[model samples]
Target: MIQLVVSIILYFVIFFGIAFILNMLLRRTWLMAFLYPFVVLIIVDNMSTMEYLKAPGSAFSEAFSRLMQITPVDIAILVAGFAGTIVSGIIIKLLRKSGYQMF
Candidate 1:
């Protein structure tokens, strides 16, 4: 619902902002673009924990534990993070191609 949409939007905003800053700092660096998605994975994982769990201390271990079940919202956040990373990369590539500098 609305919360999921908001979370996804927030994920995109953060992911894009980070990627954009890195892209500006490391121009012509494909590694950063490729690694952005993985970075988003970690960020979104943390964000998901904050969103869902009252006890944030255990969120990190719980987020990664395959044995510990995750909710649909977590999955959605992961998916959104991945999608945002990809979109950001593509947008950056296009911007570079068009010679429009952004940060």
Candidate 2:
């Protein structure tokens, strides 16, 4: 339990820390907003996944098995990477290009 909590906190900290650094290099107005945040989240998630790889829980494995739950750690990494590389990128593009009209 404690490990889980710690992992979540660490994720937030690392994500935000990377975000802060990114902000320095590029303004929030730019920097590929949606994609950038996801990239940060993915990096953080990867770290958490490493811990879970040590010993995947039986209860979790069984419960999430239907979700293609080969391993908890694998899931985390996939989710994060998927978010960063795919979902977030698409979202960011849509959002930035959304509300406007020009001829």
Candidate 3:
């Protein structure tokens, strides 16, 4: 209950944090900016899968099983990561257009 809610919040925070850092670091490169987070989400998913594999029968595994489901919070995190990347890309492009360099 409360723990699940907390886990969802944590996942959202971490996912967006990673996307933001990658966005800033690769702002000058459009493809990387758009693609890096997508790849990162795959890694995150893999991590959840690994958690499942490491403990196939336990409360820990059940918690991770719920997290891996297609829940609204999970969807929101994915959307936030994607949108943040695009918004950062657009900001970088606009800055460049205005003769401001991003590095």
TM-score of each: 0.60, 0.35, 0.48
Task: Report every candidate's CA lDDT.
Answer: 0.65, 0.45, 0.57
lDDT string for model 3 (1-103, tens) is 7766666566555644655555557654355445755464454454554654677576354554544776675566556556555665666667678998646
Superposed on all Cα atoms, the candidates' RMSDs to the truth, in angstroms, are 6.5, 11.3, 7.2
Clashing pairs in 2: none
lDDT of 2 by residue, 1-103 (tens): 6765566555445544554444444535234445654443433443455444565574335434434533575355434433333433344346558942212
Model 1 C-alpha lDDT versus the unseen true structure:
0.65
lDDT of 3: 0.57
Order of candidates by TM-score, top first?
Answer: 1, 3, 2
Instruction: Flag clash pairs in model 3.
Output: none
lDDT, residue 68, candidate 3: 72
What lDDT does model 2 reach?
Answer: 0.45
Writing each residue's lDDT as its tens digit, candidate 1 over 1-103 gives: 9988999888777766766666677764355557854454455465554534576557655555632465778677766765666676788889888998765
Local lDDT at 17 for model 2: 51
